[model samples]
Target chain A: MSDLSPVPASAVVRVDLPQQPYSIAIAAGLLDRLSVQFQDVGLTGKQVLLVSNPVVFKHYGDRAIAALEAANCKVTTAILPAGERYKTLRSVSKLYDVALKARLERSAVFLALGGGVIGDMTGFAAATWLRGVRVVQVPTSLLAMVDAAIGGKTGVNHPRGKNLIGAFHQPSAVAIDPDVLRTLPAREWRAGMAEVIKYGIIWDRELFERLEAAERLDRLRDVDADLLHHILTHSCRAKAEVVAKDEREGGLRAILNYGHTIGHAVESLTGYRSVNHGEAVAIGMVAAGRLAVKLELWNAEDCDRQTRSIEKAGLPTHIPLALDPDEILAALQADKKVKAGKVRFILPQHIGAVTIADSVPRDRLREVILGAMGNG
Target chain B: MSDLSPVPASAVVRVDLPQQPYSIAIAAGLLDRLSVQFQDVGLTGKQVLLVSNPVVFKHYGDRAIAALEAANCKVTTAILPAGERYKTLRSVSKLYDVALKARLERSAVFLALGGGVIGDMTGFAAATWLRGVRVVQVPTSLLAMVDAAIGGKTGVNHPRGKNLIGAFHQPSAVAIDPDVLRTLPAREWRAGMAEVIKYGIIWDRELFERLEAAERLDRLRDVDADLLHHILTHSCRAKAEVVAKDEREGGLRAILNYGHTIGHAVESLTGYRSVNHGEAVAIGMVAAGRLAVKLELWNAEDCDRQTRSIEKAGLPTHIPLALDPDEILAALQADKKVKAGKVRFILPQHIGAVTIADSVPRDRLREVILGAMGNG
Candidate 1:
């Protein structure tokens, strides 16, 4: 790991969509300076609805409220239940009630102040409330700050599949306070590292080397603050660049889903209980790496390096033994990316390179699942 | 009215949104030629989920199916209950189930084949199903052909208000077969004229003069096919031009809500049973006309002419006596346009001009409502 240094005052990454352009502010203590950050982005003296889960609100709600109030903004709060299970249209309906009760106008902003679940639900609510409104994402978890918070993909889950219902609603701004990560659960912290490793494999070779060099990544305290800041900045820049090229996921953005196709199947088959998103992605990446090598899309050496990087981040690189391979295959067929019953895989070509493969044979997919489970 | 002339082979009005631009195809017997239309829009040989209401499906489902199958497209169907009351998130959830059961892919097309309710729900389903898919709107009712199906505004109603939940998803193509209007109910036909009158008062003076020249607009037979075609073309063109200028309702598009502010209130206060959308819009237009005259925004003569034009369409020009004025005021406050509890209204400046008014005194709003009810 690199030597310790002060985290920069703040870094700005812009999401340059022609219709709704916004910036993300990454800093160490942004929550305390949120009023100025919002003001800098032209959000001031407005009615702001701050949405958070009970767990997140208990930790950071007061600071959020005080900051907005300090900027002469009228603040209203809606505390939702915590959990991925609570990310639903029903939960979003509750937010509408809050906005309506508060008489939030079109100009009012919705601030999501939690992890990915809260960010997704709040963003969907903001998108549908009065057709659309401004949303400012205050992502507290590493997964959200690095992935969910950077993109405009906002939605709730259906019993049939994850994010089966949502809108591509860009936020007015994204505020990431790395200090909030101190309270994130250990499992979630490790889970987020999987995505960071994903960016390294698919877009940034240097980031991949950095992960390889780090001695410890299992916990927040294991890594120095400067290293953490670099990870966040590099990962966000990779995402921002990809999103800028394809705001609606027409083409290039699909690479960001290198492991998500299989990862989603694993998550669904486990009922989203056995493995969290980051953990599932970690496992999916290992399978995808093997698939790439077998298909000759990438050499075996690069694939092995990819697997080692995932391991270095304290994430699992194998499928759970309890989940059936057949069920995973069925879930894959039902995935959103399956066009005409054919699954599309985002396979890596080498470090910092990937390609979308729409013609993966079903037998290969089945074999990979079973192989990853150690039953091949 | 002008002499009866053959309805042009087809009238195509393009909604020129830079991100997702599409065309509205207005033609006679277009349902039989659905295959060709879908191909013209680059949506051929795809898996299609056709959504319609039981009432509408009973009328045109077989023909629509035959046409798509002729194009070599695989088709599935889901029929929903017909009515504004059924336009809810629960109804949309039913669509998600249908899409999942059919294993509809991201590249699949969701075709909405009914009036406003069916189109809104289906478009929303397409928007959220797998984050988004291609949606081709087949509008059956006159209200849909001219207004609801043209703009990308797709949503369902909330218990609190109408269209309180939705996304702005532009259709890949809007196929309007005017022949289907032959089976439309008399009330719905009359209801559609209210929106036609709205376009006249807001943007097109020639349309206003044409409506005044027509002897009657009570039913499909009352107006010749030529005049009806002209009405659809002009109204749709007006909408397309306005939407092209402002796709997101930022500023120029608010003028499109000329009579909708008070119209929504009347619909909500009446529980959406006593009056349909177009009828409420008719009454709201009369009230807006009166308010415009009283505010000296337009002369009383012009306002009277506007009322006469609405009356010529065989629609009501006054709020129902049973609906209380105070409740109307309360509903107005709850309208999506209400910013900080102040109601913003689109008031007519002249026959072909309007301006958004955000500072109307409360007493004047009340007086206009009472005066339009014949109780001033």
Candidate 2:
């Protein structure tokens, strides 16, 4: 991304929820000094249940525990097997066992130290553990740091759908260390970029234009630290602001589901194996873009521009050829977001804005999905 | 028990939290008119997932379904195996399957139609399902109607502890039909009385005196209709008031756990099979009374009075002689209420009052348990 004005000295966004407001701290070495960051959010000398996947744990778990121990916390690490398939109640039940063995009190903190899956599961555990304890999120992946880790939406998936079982328990604080991205896989880097592109299209036009200016938006190495700093702050700010307005998704928050309706279906239908969450979201956004244009809700030119950004991020801009259109339609009905048996869609009216459309014609949905298939 | 003042015209206690305030309606034949009652609370034409145990399902499930269907709700029944042993995350997972198959939306309702175990698991399922949905508690047992059903405390037990995994999800409405108690087993009837006695000890002196006025508090049939109505209203009122002031058990709510501290340990040590929740609470209250008297926080006479109430209810006033006192003490350290490694006990200051004691000395606790052993 193009260089912007001087990055703020303090890159923290406050999610001012009515209850349990928290801050997201973004810096390069935040992970190393986690204990200090935890204290900043009022967690200290408490039992900490640090949950992370094996991959992330292997890289940063020791440092995270060390930092927490520095603050006099009794740290217990639960290294869950990495991947979406492992994100279930069974994994969360294991966390409960760890929490009980550690004798974690209601004042104790659950520190989620990985990607969206880790954050979601850990947060769900904290939310339900003793009717809820404090949770501190140290998001390792870009998707988690900017979005999943910031908002209080934490849950595990049901066999039938994505994130079907969860709660709105906000973290005490969200600590983000961009340095962790170096260990993230290339595919994961691109998948995260998809969510970054999502914030650009749905909330911030300046963010969209800046990503368009970048020479390469595919890899973390392609962007310098300043742009990375800008991306993190802008995206976190957008998400924080939206969540502050609607913590429980009662209203207004539905716009954040711009691509998630079909995205979730795609992920669920694939059994969360072939297509990851971000990739599915990217595909869903493309289909939504085409549908918006067909309904004359948005100009085709803006839709193409959005497509260009997704492509530049090296994300899929079309549905996988193997996923049946009819099945995808059926999966959408099973989505947790369905209200009064109506499938709701969040469609971009233009860059930096989206609207919730509840009655998208089934035929238009079918046509757009078929048209957006890979190699169509 | 002696009759209350004209049964208060209408036995409805309002749990007025800042958000999602709901009413607990207590009356005879309330279960038969559940559809109308659900409609009163603004739940109509919604998808309903009715959760119950097999025993309760056999007696009242059809009528419950008929009432819900009459209100134009699409109802699905999930009959779980009865007993505390089945109160685990695995049961909640089955509910998730049922919820998914029924396509329950955010606006949909989960109606819990049994005792505490059913309500706890169903409420937990509702709490996490799609992040959260509305739950309507139809408590069949006296225990659930007074305590478990009114408060939002919903959870499944961890293998290690009671209610170690749970959430505070306030129900949309709690409909109690005292008429259902006719089908309740004598032990269950006595168990429910234990909680009613709890209300007397912790907050309502008049309630305690009323039970003392009764010649028989051991069976539902032994009590007259007016006294039954008073028990439901007064107990619900006490729970509702405490929960409204302290929804998350931050302070005042801990008083509600008056007998639960030691009671949970007894239930856990006995594998939740030997001593049920109410019976355990009865035993716990007995132990708590002795501990309070020994510490000089409460007088022996009032402690004996509390014991007499438990005896009148046909509830156990002493720990099982078969259990080890040392092991019971060890289990206390693992309770969810333990803060900073200190086992907090709610000790009675006097009848109708209790105080939270954080540092109950280990030796003293051991002596109290040993002294309270049955036939000691």
For each candidate, what TM-score against the reference? 0.97, 0.97
Residue B366 error, candidate 1, Å: 1.3
TM score of chain A per candidate: 0.97, 0.97
Distance (Å) between predicted and true CA of A23, model 1? 2.1
Q: How would you encode candidate 1's per-residue C-alpha lDDT over A220-245 as one tens digit per residue?
A: 99887777878998999999999999
Angstrom error of the Cα, residue A276, model 1: value is 0.5
Between which residue pairs do clashes occur in model 2? none
Check candidate 1 and list the clashing pairs.
none
Please, what are the lDDT tens digits per residue for candidate 1 over residues B1-376?
2354444456899999887788998888999999998899878898999999998999999999999999989999999999999999999999899988988888899999999999999998888887789899999998998899987899999887999888888999999888899999999998999999999999999998988899887878988777887899999999999999999898999998888888999899889898899998998888998898889899999888888877777888888888788998888988888777799999999898999998899999999988877421
Best by TM-score: 2
Global lDDT scores for all candidate models:
0.88, 0.88
Native contact recovery (fnat) for each candidate is 0.85, 0.99
The residue-by-residue lDDT of candidate 2 on B247-358, one tens digit each, is 9888999999998888998999999898999999999999998989999999999988888878888888888988998889889888888887798999999678999998
Q: What is the interface RMSD of candidate 1, in Å?
A: 1.2
Model 1 CA lDDT for position B185: 94
